[model samples]
Target: LVPPDILKKMYVLRRILNPMGTVDAIEFLLGKLRETKVNAEFFEKMNT
Candidate 1:
């Protein structure tokens, strides 16, 4: 399990990086990592 302190830091970073939200920011990063072609199946699972 993730520690609360770490989660808080992630939240702060997420807010600063993208006002859209953490999930969106994660997806955006993943998309970038995959050259803007993130797998649809993986994305769907992440959203669930």
Candidate 2:
């Protein structure tokens, strides 16, 4: 059980380490989802 603060910092570190940030990953995933006719509820639930 990681604290939210630690999780936030980890997310920041991950973004720093990743050449492409989470937004890019989200966009790529969203594109793939579009091709698969993903549900609207899934999009609504997506944090991005």
Candidate 3:
């Protein structure tokens, strides 16, 4: 297992190595833990 500090660094390094507009889930989780703000809107239209 990697220490959180070191693991975070690893994630950054991995992203630097391959930043092809793909998501890096680990970074997303880290951001969430840090209380990153996210906004979403949803609309549903149905006729019954």
RMSD of each: 9.3, 8.6, 13.8
How many clashing pairs per prediction, in order?
0, 0, 0
Task: State the C-alpha lDDT per candidate.
Answer: 0.56, 0.58, 0.45
lDDT (10s digit) by residue, model 2, range 1-48: 975755665576456447867788677656656765555443344453
TM-score of 3: 0.38
Q: Candidate 3, clashing residue pairs?
A: none
Q: Considering lDDT, which of the candidate structures 1 and 3 is the better prediction for this target?
A: 1
**Alpha-carbon deviation at 18 in model 2, angstroms:** 0.4
Measured by TM-score, the strongest candidate is 2
Candidate 3, residues 1-48, lDDT tens digits: the string is 865655566566556547534457566545544552432110011111
Taking all chains together, each candidate's TM-score versus the true structure is: 0.38, 0.39, 0.38
Q: Residue 34, candidate 2: how far off, in angstroms?
A: 43
Q: Distance from true position, residue 28, model 1, in Å?
A: 14
Report the C-alpha displacement of residue 22, candidate 1, in angstroms. 13
List model 1 lDDT by residue over 1-48, tens digit each.
765655565566556557767787777766645753554433334322
Q: By lDDT, is 1 or 2 better?
A: 2
Clashing pairs in 2: none
Q: What is the lDDT of residue 40 in candidate 2?
A: 49
